[model samples]
Target: MPTFTALTTLPGQAAAEAFVEALERLEPEPTGVGIFEIEDGSGFWEVGGYFAEAPDAAALDLLAAAFGARTFVVSEVPETDWVAHVKRELAPVTAGRFFVYGSHDAGRVPEGAVALLIEAAMAFGTGHHGTTKGCLQALDRLVAAGVEARIAADIGCGTAVLAMAAARIWGHPVLASDIDPVAVEVAQANAAANGLADKVICLEAAGFDHPRLREAAPFDLIFANILKGPLVELAPDMAATCATGGHVILSGLLNDQAEAVLTAYDAAGFGLCNRVEIGEWTTLTLLKPHG
Candidate 1:
């Protein structure tokens, strides 16, 4: 079976959502439609749809014009078991004291390593990406430096691996949140699979918007492995939510974007304590000034 995907980007969330609604009523009927905000601080939203057959270009064009969006990029996707492909391509990864593996590699966990089970899934952040790996290693280094945190939060936690890692190392409940509900569900499942369900609580939220997050303010440690734009936007909230002398681990940035993110945090009263580069991604460890 041939699968086709049509995607377009527009400036506002309302336009993107309207595009998705229009796509839902298309003649051939799409299999799925999604509207997502672009997280690069572009203030743009993406609308996409999947079809079992090639979508009508004329209809797509009309929809794009109506929504004031760019022309749809339509492409045929080869039929493949993406989950299986990910399992084969993503070998178990070891970063510092953490061992991230799918269930297929359960027996490969090294002795004395904190094991995190994050199966290949639709959600991102499996520790295979440099951003996730760098964050994990940063956590390890923090532990090595004898920094112990009793309260921790993982904002934008994709698979909740960082939250699970903190739970495993510190034996405390770590708040994990993501804007996507699917990712939050995946994080919850991953935490349960790793036997940290009791210690790693997952929620659907954007940054620190939830009531639970507000009540759990002043975290001793915080992890925000998101893009530079959001990282910069989050600086003030991070500063307010982090305890005095607390630590924060951040990633999901290109090498060139690190300084801007660091500067943003610096303005929010955080000093860089350490930086780890993995491939093109840079993870930063920062400390809030002690009162």
Candidate 2:
């Protein structure tokens, strides 16, 4: 089966969402349509659709124009064994004390490293991306500095990698929440796979909105490795949920956007404790002060 994808970027979320709705109503309706914010501080949203057959280029162009988006670029996606390809391309990643690898490389985990098994099918936060690697490195640095977090949370935790890491180190239960139910399920599965099912509790929630998260307030540590916009929006909530003198590790930011996120967290009562730059991404460790 040939799969075709049509993708375009626009400035506003609203426009991108409306464009997605339009894409769903096309003559040859897309098999799936998705809208995502481009997290590079571009303030742009990308709208993409996949079709079993090639989409109508003329219709896509007209829709793009109507939505103030760039011309839609449609391309055929080659059918390949994506899992096999990812396994071949994604070697194990080492971030400080944590080693993230797929089962194919299970035998390669270092003797002393904390092993996190993440298959490529799980996708997000396999520790291969700079953002996830930065967060893991930041966590390792905190541990090396003798920081102990009894209670922690991983907000927007895609695969619960951070939560698992904390649980592995501290032997304490960590709350892992994601807005997407599918991600929450994946998190739970990953936690089980890592044998941290008892230590990492997975939930479906946006930021701190769920009851479990609310009850787990004043967490000793929090990891919000989400994009800049959500990170900024959740600053005040993070301040309230984090305990005094507790730490928050944040990533999913471009190097240029770190300052803005810092400014937001600073205003929300966090002070920068450490910052690490990996490739084009930046991870920040912030501390809440005790009065």
Candidate 3:
């Protein structure tokens, strides 16, 4: 099917929400939206929405003005070709024992490194980003701590990188979810590619708000590697799903944003177990207070 992908940056506090709402109000609604960070260094968020048909000239003109004193553009994209574009453009990622292959991290890993091979698709976690790697490292350290955990959840599992990692190394039962259909497909494919198909269950979900997420309550470990906003919003849900004394690890946050995230987590009664930094990203581990 054909789709439209538009990426736009709006300055100021509500950029992310504005772009998201505009895409939602479109006549035919986009198939998906790929949020990106432009060079602005502002909190401004970008969205690449996929539609069912080509956007006409009028669409572009309206798009440019939608942000008003901001920036935006719409491009028609065929559904089948977006993955090829992702593989060609996204940077490399390395998390824990996994090394994501891309132009930047290509050939830079040590010979004996434990690597998780991945292609750049619309799916989230690639080991190269600090948030993903931070979570992976935290997970590994937990295992190293010799804590016995039974069930695990990867909310916003993205490319299923972390889900696959947990399942592959720990052999635990895993559930992975993503709001994006493309990400769901990618996560499933990547898990099977890593021979983790049996250990990991991949599905589509919009945060912990999914029916399945509610059904599978009280997970021993939970991972959410999304933006700070969703992280804060989903705090209560993540805590509810965690088994008492169990753990939750979160990422996709900058160091400056860590304090607010910690406050949210704290309010949910999940105290900080540890924190790590990689490049410009932050990951935190938390333990549910025992009753």
Candidate 4:
């Protein structure tokens, strides 16, 4: 089988929309898959990610000939070659039970766990990034202590992996939220794939203010693996909604940026618990004040 590549340029907004559209329309097909996206600052975007069957060599030739000079790049690929390329290029990142694939030589995720079996895709959360793996490690450490958390929330739960993990590990109902509808869809799909749909409630909301958020009121444990600036800004709201005596895991911070984040949480009534570093990322777990 030959892989097919379709490349075209569209604006930023258009490119993003095209990517999402392509993703949603994709069905279970035996196609070699890989998505490569480049944004042309000139209000345009170039995109391509697909593998085609071999018998279509003539079709590929026609496609290439049809788009001769306008502005398109098309490539034909053999199926096996594409698969081998993706798997080999996608080094597995494991932190706890999460597995992520990204740059082969990168310390994408934290150490000390098994990689998940899910095939790598453009989707988020495979413990391959410092922020995501940091969160995974944080959850692993928490679970290792045999803690049973109930009523949890995952803010900006990209792939909903954290929420799914919580539900699987602690038998808790985890509420995962993200403002992006696409992210919500990805999270929901991932949750279902992992058999966690029953316990993980995926929602689209405007930050912590989503109506579904109320359903998870005063969560006993909250996971916020978003960036540092947003984490600081969300401190007050998280503090208010996170119950006293509960736990909060915060990541998406560089080791150097950990103190400022901790300071913000401290002011919001959380006491430092543990700070773990994996790669260049750090995840800090904070316990609500006892006094």
Candidate 5:
């Protein structure tokens, strides 16, 4: 069975959503349709669809023209066992004290390292991407500096890897939240796989918008490894929810975007304590002022 995808970018959220609705109505209807903000400080939104059969190019062109969107780029996705491919290609990642690996690499965990079992099929944060690795390394540095977080939260925690790491190191329950329900389920599964199900509590919420997160406010440590735009937008809320003298680790930023994120946190009463760059991504450790 072959799969096809069509992707395009439009200017506004409303327009992008409308475009998705139109996509759902097309002949050879898409198996799935999604829309997401580009998140690079660009005001554009990306709309995409997956199909079991080739989509009609003429209909796509007409929809794009009507919605003032860029022409859709359609491509056939090669049929491959993606899980098997990821298992072969993704070697275990060692970030200081944390070791991230799939079950296939179970034999490779080193002595005394905090082992995190993250299957390739999980949502994200398998520790393969520079962003996730950078964030892990930043957390390692904070522990080395004797930072103690009694209450921690991992916002936008895709697979709850960060939350699990915090739980493993500090022996405390860590709250992990993701906007997607599927990701929350994956996080829970990952936590149970690592035997940290009690320590890493997974929830479905956007940023800090859930009742559980609000009740657990004034967190001692926080992790938000989302994109630059959301990081900036989250600055004020992070400041309000974090205890004075608490710490936040942020990533999912290009090197060029680090300064803007730093400035946003600074204005929110946080001072940069450490910055780490791995490849093109930068991770920041920021502390809320005790004043």
Candidate 6:
């Protein structure tokens, strides 16, 4: 069956969310509605809805005018096997000492490499994106520098790839958490697939709010590959939760936004140790000073 999508952008989060709420209740009834920040520092949010039937264009136009948003661009989405499409589009991605691939490419993993199996899914972090690959490379560099983390956490762990990578290298437990429950579920499934289900624990939490996360506080290493806004907001919590001399590897930032995020972490008591730029994205590795 063919699916239809209607998309538009608005100035603020509240307006975008409200638009989605109204869009869901439209005559045709959307199958799903999604809202996300554009990540361009423009403070604009994108609102989109998927429908089994073509939405009423006039209704969409009225909704856009009411929300002060751009006119909705409606398109028909052709029916395709998305998983097979992903398998064909994504080749194995290798970053430093890590190799990430789907089950179809299992035979291609290089020997002695830390391998992470991530199926193509609705969630993010398959180690194919620059942000995820950069983070993996940073992890490899840390290992090269003789850094061993006994207690580690991966914030916003989408597929739990980073957390599983750390666990495979250090032979220790890793806490992987994401604000989205779907992401947490996907992460857990990926962990089981990688044979690290026992080592990488998955949780649903927003930036270290869980009791388990608090109990695992002062982590020796942490990975937060989320966007700049959340990274800046979580700086204090990251600092407080990170052990002195601990390391934090961060990404999901454009080159221009790295300075502001670094400044926030700097005030929270972290010093940059290394940086990597993959395309427009920059990944940072920082260390909390040891007194």
- For each candidate in turn, the TM-score is 0.89, 0.95, 0.72, 0.65, 0.96, 0.96
Candidate 2 has a TM-score of 0.95
Instruction: Work out candidate 1's RMSD over C-alphas.
Output: 2.5
State the displacement of the C-alpha of residue 191, model 1, in Å, after optimal TM-score superposition: 1.5
- Model 4: how far is 177 from its true place, Å? 0.5
Ranking by lDDT: 6, 5, 2, 1, 3, 4
For 165-233, candidate 1 gives per-residue lDDT tens digits of: 999999989999999998898888988888998999999999999999999989999999988879999
Please say which candidate is ahead in lDDT: 4 or 6.
6
Q: Candidate 3, clashing residue pairs?
A: 4-51, 93-127, 93-128, 94-127, 94-128, 97-114, 98-116, 124-158, 124-159
Per-residue CA lDDT of candidate 4, range 61-173, in tens? 44334433124455675446544566576577666665544434345545643433334554356666777778888888888877668889999988887887788777778
Question: On lDDT, who's better, 2 or 6?
Answer: 6
**Pick by lDDT: which candidate is best?**
6
Expressed as tens digits, the lDDT of each residue in 66-133 for candidate 6 is 99999999999999998889988999999999999988889999999888899875326888889999
Point out where model 3 deviates above 4 Å.
Answer: 1-68, 71-114, 120-124
- Which scores higher on lDDT, 1 or 5? 5
Clashing pairs in 2: none
Task: State the local distance difference test value for candidate 6.
Answer: 0.94
Q: Each model's C-alpha lDDT?
A: 0.91, 0.93, 0.76, 0.71, 0.93, 0.94
- Cα deviation at 245, candidate 3, in Å, is 0.7
Consecutive 10-residue window with the lowest summed lDDT within model 4: 32-41
Off by over 4 Å in 1: 9-21, 34-46, 66-70
Q: For candidate 6, give the lDDT of residue 235.
A: 97
- Residue by residue across 222-276, what tens digits does model 5's lDDT show? 9999989899999999999999999999999999999999999999999999998
